[model samples]
Target chain A: MNPATHRHPASYRDPAGFVFEEDGILYRQIHPRYQPSYEQLKQSGLYDRLVSEKLLIPHEEISQPNTADAFRIIRPQRIRPVIPPFCWTYNMLLDAAIATLRIQTIALQHGMILKDAHPSNIQFIGASPILIDTLSFETWIKTKPWIAYRQYCESFLLPLVIGHHGVPDSPKLLRAWPGGIPLETGRTMLPLRSKLSLHWLLHLHLHARQSRQGDTPKSSSTGFSSGQMKNLIHSLKLGTTRCHAGNKHSGWTNYEQQVSARGQYTSHKLAVIQKESAALSGIDTILDLGSNTGNYSNALRNISEKIIQLESDPQTANALYEKNKTAGDQNSLSLCLNVEDLLPAGCDHGLIPSLKSDLVLCLGLLHHLTYRNYIPLPDVLNLLAQLTNKYLWIEYIDPTDPLIREHFNPERVEQRLIDLETFEKQLETLFTTRYHTQLADSSRRLYLCSKK
Target chain B: MIHLLYLDPGNGSYLAQVIIASILGVVFYFRNLLYVVRDFFYRLLGKKDRSADS
Candidate 1:
């Protein structure tokens, strides 16, 4: 492993571990202190088999001639895309949860258990999720209760359940508190029927009580027998099945009610997109940011090879993922992402993260940033301009437009309005405005800007 | 005035379940001139179910 070019984020938690990038590749450096567990991981043949099966990324043991840290560094394989939890669609979260359970089950068979269960440790490669933290596995201790189970449930399971149960903002709530929701808070929000259930009663409510148990520690340190561990893994599999069953599918389901767009207006807007996008060829990949219910995104697929329909709302995004999955759409994909907190163009700083887009379809998202979020119009346009490569497809709604007015009471945000002319001028700076026209009587203007 | 958001399966997420519930609540409580406009508002927003039954 080359340490000269390696950059380690000092803020990373693990003391015996540090991440480094060598030769445009990212790798986790396991220290001498953690070598015993690492060797056990390799000696047991768990690492080789897992990597061969693509259950885990494989890494060759590279020797680093570093005398400073007094520990040899081993470079393990790395996942290219390190997506944070907030970027995941509900289905991705659900899958990651199942993947975690699967890994835990596999680890138990290898006479090991994962010490960490943070959702951040999981990453998505294509649609499949994998456990990226190689060091999370440790020698199995038969005498301790599954301490990480509750933590894993909190980090992965609860937010998914809450989101599916109509608390659309559950991810945000969980995001706000990274340690996962306090059991007390979950107890308050969880329905009474859930509280009465055996899992909730013991794992959640009782666990909370045990945590609150002052002097006397709550649960004894008695470990599960090998058979019990197997049973526990089976129970985890059952939980994953239940979680998957509970996830409802639909695109931005709740958000559609919040926005006001007449059918005529939406159709007209979509027609303009179709007309503009149809002419472009070899430009197979299209990204429709803020794609609610994927109405327009669904149209773009006829022109492009694949459409990545992204929406921020969980309910909506979840719906989108399910729809495409059920439709057996091999070309179109949907994801949940707040436009502002978009997955960065690249994961690591120096190395290119390989998110190349041929076209960007940004429609009806202007008011969301400008009026609702109080972001300046120029700033919103600037961010959109950065995302596009060859062609920029966009729609701009008149600030005084009825649809815009309904979303934001003009009474409160009079100054927030930006006329079409002003927006056009800004686009002229970076993009050659190729397509610009009003759609129906909605006062919505569509613009197709070619990179200047 | 308070909106109850209903998140469910099969409904095109075009209408977040909460806004519909809220609009229904509004029409039930305040039967006035604006109620017609409110219905129009919901319809225009595509919140009014076109195919799927609530």
Candidate 2:
């Protein structure tokens, strides 16, 4: 078996097809059993409608099948910086549930239904959540219950309900139950107040009880009108929307408002960063470390096409996600992550999309890693250098800056270099400075450098 | 649905949704009936007619 071509780890559950990557490009191979359904998907006009509406990721037909068991192969339009479902904020997950139901609604109208409904089937591109799996649809048999009903409830409704009840780290629970939260476990975890609502009672509480009893619809009528299925899905959508994250804590979400008060300093810093970034060419991919509400990333819109904003604080990341979503800014991807975790030794870079950026912006984040995390400065620079392909735009903050004083102690800060002499000496070893400028009224400074 | 093909849709969820959806089907049936009645009255009174529930 050549190592260059291998099946995606998570694609084993479904027998219809599996995802594989060859030389870092992803493709899906449809098994011979699913050939009929794949034909119907296109011949019925469902594929075209879904693609045009942006509800599904569009794929191109590759005439050559890669394996003996495969009947067809397709290359989907890949979305970058693949984020794990466990890390999604309350609203991100909620929007995913709605998008899933919306796709099923459209599918039902086209004489088909989703054979599987799970968060794993969805991927967010910019602010929009799109279904990536093309093999999930099957003919909608009138007598058949939405065979994926149980899967949908467990996958979407249960998680949303758990988050709604303010369970601590509910999103993290997805890591344990990636195959959709176990209905029994989720039912037990839900609060008593949840039973008060009709939709919850029917979908979760009552559903779990029946499952426990092992009740099968032996002689009972299993057929309901398509209208009823649509009605049920509509109810799920309404219920899912009501489930809120409700656990936003900390001041980082409001960091931008506080920084705006120091307008003289911020304006100057942004101006220099923008001007320096504009001077550099061929910067298609950009990464911003500690992007509090993505102010700096948003300012660099004209310079780069794709911006990856990494923010550790969940509330602040959600705020940025919400802001970008509302503005319909499809060019930016905001990921909730700790900066220290990304650019360090033995860090599991497997879960995130590859971070081989052309230009990396490390503004105002170096001091925090050095002072709070106790990491050496040279190692941080080395990690940043490895992450970017060409240029690095890093900032150096002195102990006197008010922003640094908020959470860090200036008097005991011995790990960071206070003087430019040591700072430049440490920096010049890896990158040659292209331009350097000091903010108009502050001791903070920005540096634009390229790999030597 | 459970006896059908490769995917396992949980038995309890299938059973529960059957009962709820059947009840909903009845509710929509009556809703459409009411709409028909209302529309008939509107036509009789020379008022704007309404469409049946879909």
Location of the lowest summed lDDT over 10 successive residues in candidate 2 chain A? A344-353
Each model's lDDT: 0.63, 0.77
Q: Give per-residue CA lDDT, model 2, range A1-452, as digits (tens).
A: 22115877656667788788887878888889999899999988999999998989999987776457888888899877666676666677788889989899889889999988877678788888988889989998766677788888887889889878875246557767766788888898888999987778778887888777664546235666677788788777767877877767566766767777875888888888888788899988898888887888789888888888877776777778899999999888877667676653533344424656888989878888887787787888887887788999888888767767777865547545456777889899999999988877778788999987
Candidate 2 lDDT tens digits, B1-54? 000112334343666777767766676588779888888899899987646333
RMSD of each: 15.2, 4.9
Query: Residue A235 in candidate 1 has what lDDT?
Result: 45
Per-chain TM-score (chain B), model 2: 0.68
Give the winner by lDDT.
Answer: 2
Can you write out model 1's per-residue Cα lDDT over A1-452, one digit (the tens) per residue? 55534645431566556677677766566666887788888888888767776666667766664656525565556543344565567777777788877778777778888776766667665566677777777888775546466566566666755665566546565456565666556766666666544444444555555445422232334323555555555544554455543435343465555444465776677777888778876786777888888878787777776677778777677677677767767666666666765423322212112234678888888787777877777676666666667898878877677756666867546777677678888888878988788877677788888887
| Docking category of candidate 1 | incorrect
The best candidate in terms of DockQ: 2
